[model samples]
Target chain A: GAGVSQSPSNKVTEKGKDVELRCDPISGHTALYWYRQRLGQGLEFLIYFQGNSAPDKSGLPSDRFSAERTGESVSTLTIQRTQQEDSAVYLCASSFGQGQEKLFFGSGTQLSVL
Target chain B: AQSVTQPDIHITVSEGASLELRCNYSYGATPYLFWYVQSPGQGLQLLLKYFSGDTLVQGIKGFEAEFKRSQSSFNLRKPSVHWSDAAEYFCAVGEEGGFKTIFGAGTRLFVKA
Candidate 1:
């Protein structure tokens, strides 16, 4: 893909339902990131994937939030038992490499937990 | 902990008027700063970045940002505002040796014709 691609541009779900957001990063990019943006809030770091190394999940807010990536390609963010506060925009970005490099972003998945 | 602050939630400007968006960050050591713009129903696009050297960094769409380490600020500026420039602007900061980048709340620019 020319740029980072994300799926489920908009989603509305009942509280406690699980939701999955997908991201397809640019080819040959080795770094992927997930971020969350609440209404009228800044972007919150969720997690980071660098190569085959263990993903840096330090930013995950809770156990319900989890993500996975395969071979530096497509990535998925799964939220289990979503809460009303989970309604926000989930953004995905990828970079050629880590360490202060420029990141390419996707349009993001707008999730609304009703 | 690293954080970014964009005080202006919304800014209105006339076409051809100069614009400035304020940003402040909190990070230890050298900081990697970036400016991104997001138009309605569009993905975020990188405008410019300041990693090291050259406090003044030029970016696309006639946008530029100046990194002031002393004040912990990286402000985005444009000499002339265009209708197309109406968008949400964000300032971000990345820590050294860390892949995670923190973004500001964003400032929405409205250009009046």
Candidate 2:
């Protein structure tokens, strides 16, 4: 792909429903990251994956939030029993090898929990 | 933990006027600094980055930033403002060889015609 791709650019789900956001990173990218942006707030890191290493999930806000990636290709972030507070933009980014490499971001999935 | 602070929540500047946005960071070791811009209903675009060597860095769209190690600041500047430049700017910091990047709250720029 020319750039990072995210699915379901906009999603409106009822509270307690489950939602999944997908990200297809740039071809050959070795690192992937997930972040959340609330209205008028900064981006909060959710998780990071580097190559075949164990993913860093320390930033996940709660037990309801989980994510998975398959061999550095596509990734999915799943939110179970979503709440109103979960209404925000979910962004995905990828880089060549992490570290100081520049990150390319996707358009993001705007989830609105009604 | 690494953190970034953008003091101003919003700034208004006249078109053709010079502009500057302040940013500060707290990190234990050398940090990788970055500036990104986000237009309404759009994803973020990287403006510039500072990893090593020179303290001043240039970015796309006629923007530049200087890394001041003494103050732990990476302030973005432009010689002249444009109406199209009205967007949200974010400053971010990451540790060397680390995957986590912490972004600031963001500064909204409004350009007046």
Candidate 3:
């Protein structure tokens, strides 16, 4: 696609259940990012993937949150044993690698933990 | 740790009035400042960015932002706003070669007729 694409535009899961969200970065873009935005909150950086390098997972709130990216194309964010606090819009973005400056974002997955 | 701050939670202005949204950043490396807007049910769209050289950068939708390194600020401005400009704006700061980029809480702009 010409822009970043995120799957499951909306997801509802019960508390303690696990959920997965996917993101497809813009073709040829080598920098992918994951962020979580809760109600009335700012974008909280989750993880970043640049080329074949290891992702920066420093922003994951807890052990339950994890992510994986295959090369520079697709990425997935997994939340284990979700809680109500985990309910938020998960956004994915991509850049043209290297300097990784301005980003192109996806519509995001609105996750609701019940 | 690097961070970005948007002072105003919300602002309201008439359609023809000028607009200014404040943003502040705390970072050690050379900063890459950006202003992004999110319309209702839409993704974030970059309005402007400041990498280097000229501090004043122009962007789409008649928006512009100035980078004031002395004050650690990058504020978005518009000579006159329109009703379509009503949306949430975010200020962000990133490192030159780093992967992590921090964002501000965002300022909600409301354009009134």
The reply for model 2, stretches above 4 Å from the true place, is A52-54
Give each model a TM-score.
Answer: 0.96, 0.97, 0.97
RMSD in angstroms, candidate 1? 1.2
Interface RMSD of 1: 1.0
lDDT of 3 by residue, A1-114 (tens): 988999999999999999999999999999889999998989999988887464577889999998888887899999999999999999999998777477999999999999
Write candidate 2's Cα lDDT for B1-113 as tens digits: 89999999999999999999999999989899999999997789999999999999999999999999999999999999999999999999988978888999999999999
- The residue pairs found clashing in candidate 2 are none
**In DockQ, how does model 3 score against the reference complex?**
0.81
- Looking at model 3 chain A, which ten-residue stretch has the lowest summed lDDT? A48-57
- Give one digit per residue, the lDDT tens place, for model 1 in B1-113: 88899999999999999999999999989999999999998989999999999999999999999999999999999999999999999999998777888899999999999
Winning model by DockQ: 2
> Per-residue lDDT tens digits of candidate 2, residues A15-113?
999999999999999999999999999999999988645458999999999898889799999999999999999999999974777899999999999
Predicted candidate 3 versus true structure: per-residue lDDT over B1-113, tens digit per residue: 89999999999999999999999999987798899999999999999888899999999999999999899999899999999999999999988877677899999999989
Query: Can you give the lDDT of residue A14 in candidate 1?
Result: 99
